[model samples]
Target chain A: MQLQINNKTHEVDADGDTPLLWVIRDNLGMTGTKYGCGLAQCGACSVLVDGEIVRSCVTPLDSVIGRSVTTIEAIETDPVGKAVVAAWVNHQVPQCGYCQSGQVMAATALLKQTPNPTEDDIAAAMVNLCRCGTYNFIKTAVNEVAGRKEASL
Target chain B: MKKFLLTLIAIIVIAGGGLFWFVTHKPGSPFDGETASAAPADLVHRGEMVARQADCVACHSTPDSKPFSGGLEMGTPLGSIFATNISPDKQTGIGNYTLADFDRAVRHGVTPDGKRLYPAMPYPSYVKMTDDDIRALYAFMMNGVQPQNVPNKPSGIEWPMNMRWPLALWNAVFVPSGTYAAKPQQDEQWNRGAYLVQAAGHCGACHTPRSVTMNEKALDEGGTDFLAGALLDGWYAPSLRQDHNTGLARWSEDDIFAFLKNGRNKHAVVFGSMAEAYNNSTQFMTDDDLKAISHYLKSLPGDPARDGQPWAYVAATSATGNAGKPGAQTYAAKCGFCHGTDGRGKNEWIPPLAGAASSLISHSESQVNVTLNGSARVVTADIPDAYRMPSFREQLSDRQIADVISYVRSSWGNHGGPVTPEDVKALREHTDPASSNPIVLQMR
Candidate 1:
């Protein structure tokens, strides 16, 4: 089977039902994506599939055959992803960087789809879990990328 | 006046005696005069096969109990009753039961002491089992199975209701006599299929509707009611006939065979009680036998009037556009990952919610119960399923479950109507997820 990952088409040999996370981290040797809560409860394995956020741990390989997948390895290639990453660095959103890759993917997808998203849109799209309690920093970073000021708390 | 009184007294005496004799009369068995002989190894093996076909262990034993040691409590309208021990222990089990005694109990639903077994034994359907199968089953029960010393639990029904004699009268009206005779007109495969279904398989015990008297409306495909679907326990056992909406109108013979053999197919995966049936009984069947059963089930026609319009999938308006709807956003967040935003599941692994029997049928119990309790693990060939629906009773409230279920039922061309929080609440109280989890039997 062929997979389009980060602007390159890679030929992969694995069962179709195998999770996309396995193919990405193990098969392609791209370890940027993190695996957490394999049941899709936590979004640590989030990736951009055709510019939409999807939890790759639950995404079957067959479902992403003809689509483009952007992992944390190539997040800076896309313009929106670059802005999201820049905002993340400026706000210091990673106390522990394990969940930031998925968090960045989620913010990039949200901003790409809704350039000027509301707080509700941010809340709904940025649902990834960060165990280090980096939510306030992550929220401020996404709000900056969305060009909206965080309301006084 | 004196002559009338005398006649009335005589009539009362005779009627009372006749009723007593009817209830206490023990039915004679084919092996009535035969003694227990030493069964060969192959006969015991064959008997084991027959027991599998009959799925006796399903109700006969609890998860923690020894096989056939019977302590599963079955609920009845009147009260609860426990399944009796069928092991070969002389005091606690059927160890002392002679060939005649065993035959009488298995086929005739009568113990050697003239006590009538409850209809819950499914003796109505077992009556059609062939004499050869009965002999093999008896041989296996005596020789193959080890004796368990588990004592039988008594019924919870109070005095007047607990009396077993009334079941004798119930049996005479509802139960039939003798073994199945193959129809000459049907082909060999169909007859074999029919015999398995009507006799040993006893599919109608759940699939067929019961009357006011609590007897199955029909015993075989000769009546339209056979395998037409009915509610048992809490789940609605969907129609096995050709009904387009609530039945297997869309499923092919291969699909049915695959479902029974592999525990799933493109259309649906086994859940609810069907999961247990798959794990304990159907998966053990031979390939040819499964094919025959599938063929026989497919032959039963569905009623157009009862089935209503066939299901056709219609795409949900929009994933984000329908966010205003009660359950749309919740579904996208919770269900869309696996069940897809479009309700089409990924391949045969996760079952599709669109055009599903639970989504199409009016009864919302199965959908609600499954959502609240989740599904039992469908372990096929000793491998557990990769994906399972997790229980949401703690995470979601009753209204949330109702809304999400209603949303699924109302969407994708499904006609199952809206569900209320009350329905979800009722099932939550009545159901225990631990009980539904089938312990894979090791019947060595």
Candidate 2:
């Protein structure tokens, strides 16, 4: 299978049912994408499949065979992704950092699609689960990326 | 005879004066002459660091609640006791508390109004804090934290149990009132580690066994059972002692330090209640402090008889399982995919079942709890892991859960012993699924 990840093309041998998370982590060695809940309940494996946030753990390799997959590694290349990453750092959003790649990916996707998201839009779109309960900081980071003042805790 | 009498009188007078001085004199605080306004910024910053070391935020605040506006419910054998607001709110929090009141409450577990506090506040450990630390803590609480007027919640303990007077007597008997004394026999690093573990870090609050009165079975190194390990909140905090199997005997100092700093090492990953501590507290500690902790923990001896034999990995030939046994079949069908047919999990991400503490320890509560309800999300450095264990409660029957656990325990050189169906049922009834929202405290 051929996949476009981080603006680079790669040919890999994996089963059609193999989760993109494993292919990225084990086979391709792009371990930035975590394996949180193999069942898409947690968005720890969130990635951009043609600009839409998809839970890579549940998204099979075949589904994104020819699509552009943007991960945490390449999110910095785009202006929106760069802004989100900067906001994340400014807010000190990560605690354990295992779920951050997915979080960053999800946030970037939200900014790309909505550009100016309301609290309700953010609440609805940013569904990635954080065990550290960093949602408050995450909201602040998103607002910062959206060129708004940081929300008070 | 006259000369002898005069000499005796002089000796008596001198001895009496010395005794009086010893009894009356106490260490004066550096801030004794200064007012709260005169407290230096550096001192307040130090105090904030100390607060983090003490993990004041972990119990004092709830997720989405203002920091230090305590409302976290602590479960006790008696009942649930809510942590009181320690924020500087004038009406509802500790804003009115004088420094002396704060001292007494923190070190002696006595309120300003002479009410006794439960040991759940861990004043026994706090008693060992130096006067300087106490002064700084008071300064920080007064100045650094934002005042929240959140009213305190009353404990659910009934009648006589709720009566606080007995706690005064309990305090008198069990609580030691003084700062930590450095042991002459140990090095500076060792003593620092001791002070941090016994006082500020309050490792014993979870690790040490409690008496019927809920007093820690031992306070410090003087007691053999100190840090020997205990069961609390359905999880067993493994011994910090040097037991090869259940404790840090096999782990080097680096391993301990790594676990504290990074939350996971080659041995195991932090989960359950410890994940919270790692997320909020230990990960922020300096490398020197983490090393000191490791040094102190490693010095403790393990209980050989209690820990049993050290574990060694025994490889299984194939991914396929033994047929006919329902327990083996259950393991193969349900657990084998992720855990592997051999029972050894993949790397640090998926913890290996072979020689895993949850599977090998005598305490079966954690095993049962995780198996039934699955794990709470492990978020370190704000990054949630991509993988988590899904809840098996709905999918597996109590008997099946018991069988699978028993099979795991007996197999792969794991010797945690058998768990009965009744045990699973009891845990099933009491425990709830791990909430995706872990207790995250935003300590300023």
Cα lDDT, all candidates: 0.87, 0.82
- Per-residue lDDT of candidate 2, residues B1-444 (tens digit): 999999999999999887555433332333334444566898888888788888899989988699999998988778999999999999999998777778878887777777778888989999999988888888888888999999999899999879877676677689886889999999999999999999989999989988987889998988978988899988888888888778888789998998898777667777777877887888777889899999999999888898898788766544534444457766754565456667765445555677877777889988888888887666667766545666889988989999999988877778889999999999999888877665457776
Q: Report each candidate's C-alpha RMSD, comma-separated, in the order given.
A: 2.7, 16.0
B369, model 2: CA deviation in Å?
0.9
What TM-scores do the predictions have?
0.92, 0.71
User: Please, what are the lDDT tens digits per residue for candidate 1 over residues B32-92?
Assistant: 8887789999999999988988998888887788889998899998899999999999999
Position B379, candidate 1: lDDT: 81
lDDT of 1: 0.87
Once model 2 is optimally superposed onto the true structure by TM-score, how far is the C-alpha of residue B342 displaced, in angstroms? 2.7
Best by lDDT: 1
Question: lDDT tens digits, residues A1-153, model 1?
Answer: 999999999999987768899999999999989999766767899998999888898788988999999999999999999999998888888987999999999999889999998888888777778898989998899999888777422
